[model samples]
Target chain A: MTYCVAMKLDSGMVFASDSRTNAGIDNISKFGKMRVFTRVGQRVIVTLSAGNLSITQSALNLLEQRARTNPDALGIWNAISLYDIAGLLGEAMREVKNRDGEFLRQNNIDASASFIVGGQIAGETQRLFQVYSEGNFIEASLETPYFQIGEIKYGKPIIDRILTPATDLTEATQCTLVSFDSTMRSNVSVGLPIDLLVYRNDSLSVDIQQRIEDGDPYFSQLATRWSEGLRGVFVNLPKPDWLTPKI
Target chain B: MTYCVAMKLDSGMVFASDSRTNAGIDNISKFGKMRVFTRVGQRVIVTLSAGNLSITQSALNLLEQRARTNPDALGIWNAISLYDIAGLLGEAMREVKNRDGEFLRQNNIDASASFIVGGQIAGETQRLFQVYSEGNFIEASLETPYFQIGEIKYGKPIIDRILTPATDLTEATQCTLVSFDSTMRSNVSVGLPIDLLVYRNDSLSVDIQQRIEDGDPYFSQLATRWSEGLRGVFVNLPKPDWLTPKI
Candidate 1:
């Protein structure tokens, strides 16, 4: 289980992913789920993955192999647009499926992996896309400016309430972290050592790619403050007076 | 799809269930998922259900039918303990499965249903139980005071934050409604016309059982106030300073 969220705000994009993975309650491990591909000032592509770790890692390795052996081929570094990056990623997924799908199916493990690919490529606009197990993808639009993969529901209410196309990057980033915090608090499968990246549109480079651990000052402060704020609001709401006499 | 939540607090118990049922999106209809059985001043039993409406309705009908026929069998009204009522409901579920399981399975539909049953029976303490499709049930303990069924995730965060054994009946009731409101906002399958039941410990008969529709004054007020309150909290939280620099 993992939780990754990416927002395509008017100002830029925000990507966050949790690092914990578990086969069951007893077998848990920490692994980085966010992969960054960048050519400094030319392009930056962030991919957050969830599902079978082996499959996803294999797919990533295959993509990197392509980039190394054939830089001029359609790999992440050379992809002209975010859509092309998504396609190349999808192609990598299919390649993995062709190689491992039958063996995994025989062992009753579905050849599964999904990703959120978002960032800027040289000439195109910043965009976010959610890639599916089938290697198909859908880009975020103005109406739905964010995409969430993995344990999404526990953290979705806050995002649904506060995010919009016009939301500033600062607020969106805060909201994403808060969303991650809420999810982590409720679900043990999603844990610390979060990978957070913020990209300012047209920069064509990684902006703020920080690793947030258990005691990161800003994240800790924001989480504690938000929880307290929620409690305060909860208490301030008028109690259902009608319930007094009835129950 | 349906959403129902129930909590057993030291003060009493709270049960809330949405009234939407759908065979498909186009075939959606309204039916109360909550059923109340009360022998005034003696006992009150509330059952909130989710899943195949036909199966749950059949199970409830069987329980009621047995009460009418045998009277001394494990009928809710005759049960001496809340656990007995849960057992009776679970037995009823098995009966439904025995009767309809083959036909449903042949059609490739799951003979699935789950219930949150809570109340006070004469001579026994107040209790809550979550009954499963297999006619098995588990009682809520102090550590986990609440149970939710059907489309549960969207509304889970509020309960995780607010519910505790010491939470007062009024606060628990409000929290349950807010949880339902969050779920209803995000899911089309779970809608208005909610059935909310509140039970006070020791006082067997229901304290309040209200039918809350889309325009019910108190609920409408709470919904509006909650949304505004959440937005207010979002704005009040200090934005991460990092993104501001990028912008």
Candidate 2:
């Protein structure tokens, strides 16, 4: 199980991903799920993945191998637009499926993997897309400012309440962390260290990419403050007076 | 789909269930998932169910019929302890499975159902049990004060943050509503016209059982207030100040 989310906001895009992966509880391991492809002044692409780690890793490794061996061949750095980059990533996923899908099916394992690919090319606006297991993809729009993959429900309510196309990058980043905090508390499958990246619109380069661990000071403070704030608000809300006597 | 949760607190118990049932998204209908069995001066048993409405309704109907015709047949009213009532409910589930499971399986349908039963019997302390599709059940303890069935994840974080053995009945009731509200907002499958029941220990009767509708003034106000409160708290929290502009 995993939890990864990306938001395309007015100011920029925010991406967050949990690092835990497990075939079973006893097989749990930490693997960084965020990949950054940067070409200094030309483009910056961030990809967050979830599902069968082997499949995602294989697809990613194939993409990285292409970039290293043949920079012009379906590499994130060489893609002209975010859509082209999404297509290239999808092609990579399909390549992996062709190679490993049959073996996984024979072993009764699903050849499942998904990804959120978002970034900006030198001349294009920042955009985000959610890539499916079959390599199909959907881009975020005004109506849906955010996309979440894996164990999404526990952390969704907050995003649904607060996210919009006009939301600022900083607020969206905070909201994403709060969302991750909520999920981390309720679900053991989604653990730290969290990979968080914020891209400023039109920067065409990585802005802030930080790792949040279990004892990270800022995250710890945010969690405590959020919990206290909720309790305070809860107490302040008016109790149903009609049920007072009965209760 | 349905969402029903029941909690056993030190002070008493709380049970809440949404009233939506759907064969498919377009075939949605309203059906109460909660049933109250109270032989007034004797026992007050509340059962909240979720999944496969037909199967759950059949199980409840069977329990009701048994209690009506064979008054001494170890029904909820005749059960000496809450544990006995739980056993009776589990047996009812098994009976329904025996009658319908094969036919359902043949049609490629799952005979899925779950229940949360909580109440006070004349002689024992208030108790709560979560009964599964297999007719097996587990009781809630001090460490885990609540049990939720069907579309549960969207509403789980709030309960995880707030529920405790010492939480008062009113606070617990409020927490449950907030949780349900979150679930409803995130999931179209779980909807309005929620049924909320509150029981006070040794009261020997329902303290409050209310149906909250879509336009219910109090609920609408609570929802708006909570949303505003959350936004306010979020804005006040410190933003990540990690990235400084290069000199």
Candidate 3:
């Protein structure tokens, strides 16, 4: 399982994805799911994918091959808009599935994969899109400024409460990590070594990118402090007056 | 859809269930999912249900009729332990499914249902059990102190963070309400009025019972206060120093 969240805030964009893949419990392995495409100072496209590793890897490989072999092919690096890049990624997914999906189905393995594709091009504002397994997609808007894919439910309530279009990059990153922490605690399939990238709007390049593994100082402090703060808040929440019986 | 949660705590037990049901988006209605059976000062058995409402209702009706018509039939009131009552409930579920499963399947509707049965008889200690649709059940223990059914994932994180066998009844109730609040916020299928019951361990009778509808004062206060408190904690979370460029 994967838990990747991306927010298209007014200030910038925040992307985080876990690095765990498993064919089954015994065959679990670490595979970073964040794919970064950049033409430095021109465009930066980040894709976080979930589902069958083979399918997603194949789809990404196809996109990368296209960009590298043919610069004028209108792929990730040269796309006019984030929306066009998202379309290319979805088409790549269909191409890969059409090649391998039948073989996977014969072996009773699910062949579907999805992606949270978001970033900025030279002329366009930062945008976020979640591409479905069927090669269809939807873009995030002001009303829904964030998109989460894979193992989303356990960590959804917090994001639903704290995120908005006007939220700053730093705060959105904090919220995304908190959401990841909640997910990792509840589910074993979503493990550590998160790939995090923060894109300041209009920069047209990536600045802050780090892989967060176990015992990272700031993440550790934030997680422990958040837990402690929640317990503190819970203890102070007023006990229902009706819980006590009049003697 | 429905959301019901029950915890087996050392101080007693807490059961809370939403009152919303829907055949489809346009066919939503309110029907209390909680049923209480008490032989005052002797036994208090509570059943909270989820899944196909018709199947669960029919199963409960069968149990009620059996207990009422034949005092010597060894039904819920005279069951040796809560375990026996859980088995009875599971058996009732199987009977109802066997009767209605064919028709529902023909129409492509699910015929499955489940129940969280908990409480005590005169000779037994407090207990909780989650009866599955297959007529199998598992009892809650010190390690696993709670059970939730239907629309459960959105509300699961808070309970995972806070609930324990050692938690007091009031605190457990608060946690359950917070969980319900999270669920209702994220999904429209689960909503008020919530039927809440708190049972004091070994009392063998229920004292506090309330149908908390919309505009209920304490619930409203808690929900609003919880959201505010979470925002407070999020702001206080320290931003990573790495986010800043060394000037």
Candidate 4:
């Protein structure tokens, strides 16, 4: 299980992913689930994956191999638009699924995986997409300005409350980390260090990519303060008038 | 889909359930999921249900008929402890599954269902149990003092943050509603009017059973204030020092 979230705001985009993966409770390990691709001044594409490690690793390996061996051919590096990049990712996922889906399914394993891929590509506006295991995708819209993959529900409420297309990059970063904190608390499978990247719209370069390890001062402070603040707010909320008297 | 949660605290117990039921997105209806049985001053047992509506309704019907038709049959009404009540409920559920499970399975429908049953019988202290589809059940312990059934993840973080065995009944009730609020906001399948009941320790009577209808004043106020307070806390948190300067 993993928890990854990405937001495409008017000011920029934010991407975050946890580094925990488990085959079972006793067979847990750490793996970075985010991939960053950069062509400074031209493109800055970030991808956060969730699902079978083998399948995503295979898909990512295929993309990287294509870029390395055939730079002249169309690949993530030369894709004219973010849509093309998402399509390439979807194709890679489908290729891997076609190869591995049956073997895993025979053993009653889930072969499905998903990715939140988004960034700017020189000529167009920054866009975000949630690519499915079936080689299809949907872009985020004003009505839904973010995409989340894997162990997503525990962290969803806060994102639903705070994020919008107009949210600033820094505030969105704060919200995303708080979301991760809530997820890490409720679920042990999603642990630190968190890989986070904040992209400024039109910058076409990765400026802030921070890995929040255990005991990292700022993340520790933010988690503690968010928890304290939530409690403070809850205790101060007006109790039900009827129940308050009885208590 | 549904969202139902029940908590057993040192002060008492709190139970809540959303009323939305759907065969599919287009085939939606409302049915209260919380049922209370009270023999004032002697016993007060509450049951919250989730999963196949037909199965739970049939099981509840079976329990009601047994208690009404044969008082000497050791039914819910005569159960010596809340555990006995939970067992009776489980037996009824098993009977329903035996009758309905095969047919539902033949059509590829899920026959599983679960219940959170709790209350106090005369000589016993209040206890809570989560009865599974197979009729086996587990009692809530001091460490895990609550049970949630159906669409649970979105609302779980707040409860994990605030609840403890020592939490008071009013605060638990408040916490429960906020959880429901979070679930309802994120998943439309779980909706109001919410059915909520608060039971005080050793009080063998139903004191607070609230149906938070759409536009219910207190719930509306709580939801509004909570959203505002969360945003307030979020903005006030110290931004990550490194990112703050860049933004």
Candidate that beats the other on TM-score, 1 or 2, i.e. the better one: 1
By lDDT, the candidates rank as 4, 3, 2, 1
TM-score, candidate 3, is 0.96
Candidate 2 clash figure, as a count: 0
Interface RMSD of 2: 2.2
Off by over 4 Å in 4: none
Alpha-carbon local distance difference test for all models: 0.88, 0.89, 0.91, 0.93
DockQ computed for model 2 against the true two-chain complex using alpha carbons: 0.63
Q: Per-residue lDDT of B56-174 in model 2, one digit per residue for the tens? A: 89999998888889997777678889888788788888999899999999998868999999899888888999999888899998899999999999999989988999999988988
Looking at model 2 chain A, which ten-residue stretch has the lowest summed lDDT? Answer: A71-80
**Winner by lDDT:** 4
DockQ of each: 0.71, 0.63, 0.60, 0.83
* Model 1 agreement with the true structure over B1-247: per-residue lDDT tens digits: 8999999989889899999999879999999999999998778989999998888999999889889998876677777788888888888888888989999999998779999999998888899999988889999999999999999998998899988999998889889989988898888899999999988888988888888988888888888888898888778887666656666
Q: Is the docking of candidate 3 incorrect, acceptable, medium or high quality?
A: medium
Candidate 2, position A74, lDDT:
62
In CAPRI terms, where does candidate 2 land?
A: medium
At residue B216, give the lDDT of candidate 4.
93
State which candidate, 1 or 3, has the greater DockQ: 1
User: Which portions of model 1 show Cα errors greater than 4 Å?
Assistant: none
Q: Residue B198's C-alpha lDDT in candidate 3?
A: 93
